[model samples]
Target chain A: MTEPTLQSDLNSFDLKAFLTEYGRLVVAAMEKRIARYPEESRVTQAMRHSLFAGGKRLRPILCMTSAEAVGGNKDHVMDVAAALEFIHTYSLIHDDLPALDDDDYRRGTPTCHKAFDEATAILAGDGLLTSAFEILSHAADDGLLPAEKVLTIIAGISHAAGCNGMILGQMLDIEGEHESLTREELEDIHNNKTGAMIEVSVFSGAYLGGGTPEQIAALDVYAKNVGLAFQVIDDILNVIGDPKVMGKAVGTDAELGKSTYPALMGLDGAQDFAERLINKALQAIVSFDNKCDPLRSIATYILTRSR
Target chain B: MTEPTLQSDLNSFDLKAFLTEYGRLVVAAMEKRIARYPEESRVTQAMRHSLFAGGKRLRPILCMTSAEAVGGNKDHVMDVAAALEFIHTYSLIHDDLPALDDDDYRRGTPTCHKAFDEATAILAGDGLLTSAFEILSHAADDGLLPAEKVLTIIAGISHAAGCNGMILGQMLDIEGEHESLTREELEDIHNNKTGAMIEVSVFSGAYLGGGTPEQIAALDVYAKNVGLAFQVIDDILNVIGDPKVMGKAVGTDAELGKSTYPALMGLDGAQDFAERLINKALQAIVSFDNKCDPLRSIATYILTRSR
Candidate 1:
């Protein structure tokens, strides 16, 4: 599969401009909704800090972009998109706890536990996680979609967040930490940890947008490819990207002896693998109309982004 | 507000029969569902141990009794009942972790982290928590209730388990460990920790049983009283009850200098308080028919149980 040239894709659509606009809307909505929690508790404040801290709202953007590609209103997808961001944020907060990653820095800011206390950080993660489903269940009040479809979307979100997916991924990641991992072992970890929620972002939008079975199926393929590509790029960035651009400490993967795409395959080979996956993602979107150009550009952006 | 005599209220209710029957069913169903995951993974096995370890299936029994009080089928409430147990069990597993309670025993069996590892116990708790919602969503296939009600029940369960409720209680409990707590402060902690889920169990069963607004209102009051009384009894038992019956260490509450109703109110004052709450619980059920006898008896039983 031939990958789309990043230069040409950037020229066709201002990738940064689109992401920036969508990213602003996504982050603003997430922050506003999270802030709606009563401000009395220190835990809620800590949760808001972790949630609103500056990171590219990539998951929510993917959700909104997919909805727009399917001709659904972007406004209709805002709450759902925010809900995706909540799930993503919750995962990060939990992952950074002392029992988990024990990282002090994330996105150039102190992690939730470092900024607050460990117990507060744990509760903050729990708050964000439960709030994600709460937001999804209430999406029907927006009147942008039918109640049944909203339920289906919630179910999809629940499944992705549940034991069969992201939680399982975290479990495997913990287990694999002290043990050496094979290529297949590493793939399985990334697939659950990152791939599950990423897939849900697109499929949930497709469901809300009233896509047919075939479109939903096609979007799943696209989501899986992009998800894997996203992780591969992350692994590569950890090894070679500028610390200023990447935000957090880089090369920690090698320091921790964690398995990575570049570790299994050399840096050049890992880049090739990411490029191949990006092409596959693009191919999955071929049946869609030109509205899907954003999706294609985003896939290319996955490979080309500095952060 | 005179309390009903224990012999008059629960002497004939056969508590052993209820506990044994419901306990077996709850454990079997939970074990079967958890075992569906690959056993080779240490985390999955750890999750199973935490889930299956011998504990009184008190929450599910409360749910079943609540369903019966409304003249609803026992099987009708089984899924949600099981779900409540799962949530309770997951919280216990997480609470027993080194980062949390750091207990080595639960119900006379090894704590999850002791039986497995700390990381596996964490993931196991995560898996179980997420699976509770999954089980509720899939309850539609059981044909006992409409999907919409199931969704509403899920929403309520999420709210209780999330930050404002049980998790909040946990945060407060941890914070209270080194501090002197006022009576109001202790009430807030107990309300969020145990009372939230206890309240939800009644509401969930009522929702499924086609309870009227008045019945639901009445049950809410009934639940509040029993939930608190349940905690008061637990506190008393910690100081004076037989450890053989309680299954885990007793007096550890005082050893840890934890706040409790008895600790703050004194034994006689706590007893008076329990009587007052039990009377309030009975008053709430005065509007119900003879079908409410089981609910009334259970409230009385809260004061009389040794373990």
Candidate 2:
């Protein structure tokens, strides 16, 4: 399929409209998957409460856009996109646990533990994590991709989200609490904790979309820069973004003594880094034509997003 | 490969020797897999602590034995077996959390939370859960099974282990604490919490082993009965077995006001029920020849085990 006419008309780009149309699709897929369980059950209720809670649905959107950029079908990637959201949501739930970030609210509402109990929240997180794999396996069964490719995707995702990836980042985050970290150490933490999953999200989409080796390599480069920029922006937001706009309180990273980009680099320096990274991200995808505009816009949006 | 002579030599069968030989293989594989991570890392250390704590490698053994019973090679099923143990170990780590059963020790050693911090313990559990999928994906990559079959196995296991299965069971168990539960309610909890995963373990093994539909169905029935009996025997052991022998405390269920077979039924009645269940388990596989002796022996061993 050729690039959509609307995508080529970049001057008329509307991030809100784009997200609304695509985000609804992602949310619908997520809801359909979650609805398969008994709705009245507490665990189900807990899962739905957090899942349907407000978020921008960025990861799933990124995944779908990455797939489309590679000339892959959106229908074929929807399950995987939803799976990414599930994993993302599960991580948020766990991060809100009393033992972790201990946040009372997320996205301006009661966190899972605050909505239910700690035990229920933990189970809900676990249920979501396992459910993500379940959904991907079904995607393979549904012939979204060859089973071998799906298996490869699953393995890649597990590694990215597992100990040496997101979990490692989380471990480093917890350990770094109250301790000062060098810029390098902080980069290592964010790369593992937040960047790994984001990179995998994009890589998974490109792979499932049947991108060529060169295309996948370019997207990987693009995703890494985007991921780093995304986290840096997050750090900047925590320092200055309004709580209401951001959907949660700001400055908690500093309050908790987290090793954030703004803490390691000065605020202006962190902002400069995010801008440079986004430029690099756009440059990595320069070989692709208008078909990849969504990715390009997303890199720009990551730096400019209020939340 | 036909049944090994030792498996057919029922008169001279020694469960200890059999478990020793096979258990070593399962444990060694598990150790090798765990060793892939950074050795000195805290999360890895926490994961290894519970993983190598010397539980009877029953689930993995069941997986391998089921595969063998169906004429599939052990090497083909080893990764799945190890994945099962990873899931089992992760569940134990979570179950031992302060918000859950609050056990200080498992297998006569400090629980993960007690040994490591609670956050590390939680991350360890998460790491193991993700790693299980990672290993299975590798199994697919290694050509252990057709990718389609591997995807099917992953879906089945997730359904059995996720909200509707193990997590559901766990949620029910937590909610039922300090409350009176009818026999049916308790059964539902155990069936989901314990039986679901066990059933999946056997089903995965049988499916991956290329079992015929009839063979898989029979194993499912056998697994259901064996799983329930296994839990029942666990209750009996808690009430009567020595702590040193069991390698954990006894009577905690009763103390927590949790329902058990011995609670609803008298001691003799519970024991009788376990015997009946084992017989039913054995009967399910009776259609097969002496090649199925290990399964039959496992059923008997479940009833007779001290731990």
Candidate 3:
């Protein structure tokens, strides 16, 4: 597959507008549905605080874009899209906990535990994680998707979030702290920790969109490249990007002694590597027509944006 | 429903033999599966250590008996039974962590974190929790049950394990620490933390056994009674029972200033309360034929046994 040539500049894409308009509605709906968990218990409230915290709903947007790219209804995919956001948000909450990364801030606000108690933060993470499947199961029962497809989506999401993927990555991340990590070690951690879920976002949407096996296979490749590129850029930004734009403490990697891509590959080499992966991502989407433009734009956008 | 007359006498039923044999096999299987995560890896090994440490497989046995009482195959329910165990084990791992109950010993061995480290213990809990759903999903695909039935079981299990149930109970339990809790407050915590999952076990087997709605409703009542009885007895044991048979430190409740039934009600009063709930549990299952005798016997066993 050849890389798709860009018709418009990356700066022309209005991600802020896309996220603010459609993303806000999607996230609000998600928070409302999740908040319906009986009485407004402390656990539920903590989960809502982290989940509804404002951010670019990139995962959900990817779900919607993948659905639209395949001529599926954006509205039909909305619940599943929101579910993806919950999973992402929950991971972030747990990752920031004292037992984990011990971060004080997330998305420009005090972390969940900082806002609440450590125990509340833990339960909040558990609540969000479980609620993701709850949302999917409820949507399946409501006929948002076919039972078989819903089963597939549920299984896929669980695998991505579970031991063989995200949890395993997290274990490695915790173990890797303050220790020198090999290049391969860094790749494994980021690939599973971040890449697996991102891949699930794109692949689940594609599968639910009724993409052909070949198309789904192609999207997997695209997703892996884009996921890695996303992380590489994140590492680069950690060192050089403005804290105002990132909404997180700058130089956290340096302070934490984290093994990041830029630390291992150097800034220039990491930039080149990200560009190559972005090119590969763009190339993977070449089988589609103009409908795939947004996907192509997203790949470029991953590297072009400062945050 | 009439009160279930104890089979001739208490000695006529031998729960020890039943639990001993099946519990051993269940623990062995669980240990083997957990060990597969790699012993060289300290994190996975810590999870395995706590998970595999010997404990009575009472919950899974309850599941198996319920399936058998409804004339379902025990082998068919193994996956569901294991899933039940996984959820229970995950709860224990999390509860024992320093951030939660901070217990040093569980099942006569060092807790997961005490055996390894805090971060490993956390990941282990997360891994086990996710594995429960993974096991259930795989069981469904392997033709253990129909897709619809599998979805029902998964939905039920998730609901019991999620915010409305176990997590909420845990949150309440944590909040209740060092505070004077009323009887109602203690009951609410146990009902969700312990009762919800116990109810799920019975419901899972019955649903898989193709039980009628009426039967399911009856079993739900039965489960609620036994679940409360189990906790009440636990509280009583903490006050007066032998720690050797209990296999863990006792009287820690008072030391930690945690609320308990025995703390609110005297030891004798707690025992009386437990007996009343045991009778109530038996009443709930009176409509079932002799096939349910094991469940009735188990209910009696719960209140009378040293453990």
Error of 1 at B240 (Å): 2.3
lDDT of 1 by residue, B1-307 (tens): 1232444354557555656787788886776566556677666777778777777677777777777777787778777887888888888887877767778888878888788876677667777777776677677765667767776777788788877788878888888886899999999999999999999999988878878888888899999989999999889888888776666778888887799888898988998999899999999989787767767777877788876
Q: What are the per-residue Cα lDDT tens digits for candidate 2 across A117-210?
A: 9889888989899999999888866544788888888988898889889998898899999999998998999899889888888888898888
Mark the regions of model 1 whose C-alpha exceeds 4 Å error after superposition: A1-12, B1-12
Flag regions of model 3 displaced more than 4 Å. A1-13, B1-13, B28-40
Q: Would you list the clashing residue pairs of candidate 1? A: none
For residue A260, give model 3's deviation from the true position in Å.
1.6
DockQ value for model 3: 0.58
Clashes of 2: 0
Lowest lDDT 10-residue stretch of candidate 2 chain B: B1-10
Most lDDT-accurate candidate: 2
Tell me how far the alpha carbon of residue B273 in candidate 2 is from the true structure, in angstroms, after superposition.
0.4
Each model's DockQ score: 0.49, 0.77, 0.58
* Candidate 3 backbone clash number: 0
10 residues in a row with least lDDT, candidate 3 chain A: A1-10
Q: Residue B98 CA error for candidate 1 (Å)?
A: 2.6
Fnat of every candidate, listed in order? 0.40, 0.84, 0.55
